[model samples]
Target: MNLIDTVRIALRALLKNKMRAALTILGVVIGIAAVTTIVSIGQGASRLVQGEFQTLGTNMILVLPGNTKRGGVRQGGAPTLTSVDADLIGQQCPEVLASSAVVWTQGQVIYGNENWNPKEMLGVGPDFLTVRNWQLEAGGFFCSSDIESNAKVCVIGHTLIPKLFQTTNPIGQLIRINNVPFRVIGILEKKGANMVGDDQDNVVLMPHTTVRKRINGSPLDNVHAIMVSARSTGKMNVATKQINSLMLERHEISPGDEPDFTVQDTTEIAEALGMITGTLTLMLSAIAGISLLVGGVGIMNIMLVSVTERTREIGIRMAIGARGKDILRQFLIESVVLSCIGGVIGLVLGTGASVGATVLINMYKPGTQWPIVVSIPAAIVAIAFAAAVGVFFGYYPARRASRLDPIDALRYE
Candidate 1:
């Protein structure tokens, strides 16, 4: 028989037992669907994380308080960083473009009849806006004069507008932080959220001097952290080393001794998070792949059973002068057609599932930008792999049927 005839015969045989064929195909469908859904979701989550990091400035770096040890006892978060250190870093570190001393507190902010509690009330230097690469929606940032004179001026984030100001313009208006009145000089542009889902816009920024002397009553020299920006992306490592060396010398610490502060850059943090997400994606994909293996085994079992049930038919075909290789080809084609059908169905279901998952995530998070990304290459590969599975599993069964003795097979039936 010709190739066309063999395929037609194979299809007709499978159609004779539609229920059995469907049960076998369902196994492959489940396998392909699982793999596709997992890979698509994993890739989407990775993209979301990367986007969040990019939303924050890429060249930013943070100088935070490290652990301190005194008389063999370790203490968490020593108050060692200061405004002077921030200034020195800006002036001395060639790779550092700007630096800001930051102090923070949390309290109720009152404007007229409205009162709101923001996520952060920050005391930052004049260069804070430069270091963070933040922009003002209206008015302008505080200048050096404000820091020197300890001016009672502050900037508000976009989220605070609806909570406190209503329709009134926030700029040039008076708001009280912990009951201490300050004029709002600037309004920050909106930033939705960070990687960890913290609302970035629920904040208030004032000069470090004002926050130290007026609001919190902390020492003017002490600061909670120092924020800095590297001159360029390539200069981040050099800037970190320069800051570390300057801090060690300024603090009078030895070369091998542990310092009282730590330096961290956004580049390193982004890479670390990417690594974690990538590893998780790969691990989950592998777990999903197990289903594909199970499906292949199921195909083999069904094909072997088919060979036994069709033994008499195989004898009649051989008696009618059908070649062994022809018989094998027909069986192999039947198995491939079965798997390809399942693969197509699975691809459609998987794509739908990915989109549904994205919708569900957005519903829970509200403003999150979770995406549905179906890979075309992955879909094509899945279908091809399904075909390969059919060939591998059906070969033994087809060979057994092809090798049967014609006269003995016909007599047995």
Candidate 2:
């Protein structure tokens, strides 16, 4: 038969037994859906991780407190970063553009009758916003004079403002932190949650001096950590090394002895996190791929049954000058049609599922936008795999149909 004629015959055959055809294609639908959904989730995760890191900026170094040990060995002491170290680094390191020593205290914040107990309460220098690249959405960060003079001013995060103040213009309003009052100066532009689920939005920033004098009751000498930013990407390594060496010298650490503080590059940390997330994506995709193979097997089983049921029909067609290749083509096309139909259905379902999953994930994590990305290559591969299953599974059935004797088929039924 001609290709078009063969397709028409195949469609009639499948239409004649609608439930059986649907059952045969069920495997393909499931396999395609699983594969497509997995790829979408993987791509979404990779994009989310990359975007999250991008917001933190590039070529930035964070000097954090405490030391890491190995094998039950005492490795180091807590980081005792002070304003003096921050000033020294800013003066000595040419690669460093801005440096800030950060201190913090958590307290109950009250605006009128509303109150909040946010976890992330920070005391930062005037240069903190500059070094960390934080932008103001509503007002401004405190000035150098504010930190030096211990001004009772604060900048609230997007999440903090609504929870405590309730749609009020937070600027110029006084809020009490642990019963100590501070005027609202600015509202920070919203930054979404990081991988650790820490509330990047629910924070309150105050001057380092105010934290020391009013909140902490400690001398204005020590800090929790130092944040530093390089002028360009090229200067990152040099800046880190310079800061490390400077700390070692200041702390009087000798060669082969570990330093007290840890200087971490945000870019490297981001790359490492990306690698981990990427690996997880691949693993999930692989697991989903197994379903496709199962679907292929189902196609084979159904094709064999079809050959058995239509044995007499096959004999008559062969008797009427039909070649074995023509018979083969007819059966193969039937399987392929089933697969293609299933693939289309699966594509719709997979896309919808991925979008729904992304929406739900975003709802739980505000400002973290994860988009459901359709993988074109994955779709193409799925279609190709369906065609391949048709060829592989339809072959034996087609051959069995073609090999039947014409006289015997006429006599049997």
Worst 10-residue lDDT window, candidate 2: 72-81
> What is the lDDT of every predicted structure here?
0.87, 0.82
- Candidate 1: deviation at residue 405, Å? 4.1
Q: Distance (Å) between predicted and true CA of 306, model 2?
A: 2.0
lDDT of 2 by residue, 1-413 (tens): 68999999999998999998888878878877887887888888877777776666546788876564567586565546787888788789889998887887888999888999986898887777778778899988898899789999999998877798777799999999999999998999888777557778788999887897889988648888888888887889999999998989987778987776789998787678778877887788678767767777787788888888887888788788888888888888888888888887877788888888888987887556676788888788877877787677677777777677777765665
User: Which model scores highest in lDDT?
Assistant: 1
How many Å off is the CA of 158 in candidate 2?
A: 3.3
Top TM-score hit: 1
Question: Any idea what lDDT model 2 has?
Answer: 0.82
Clash-forming residue pairs, model 2: none
Candidate 1: segments with Cα more than 4 A from true spot: 1-13, 71-75, 194-197, 231-235, 312-323, 405-412
Q: Clashes in model 1: which pairs?
A: none
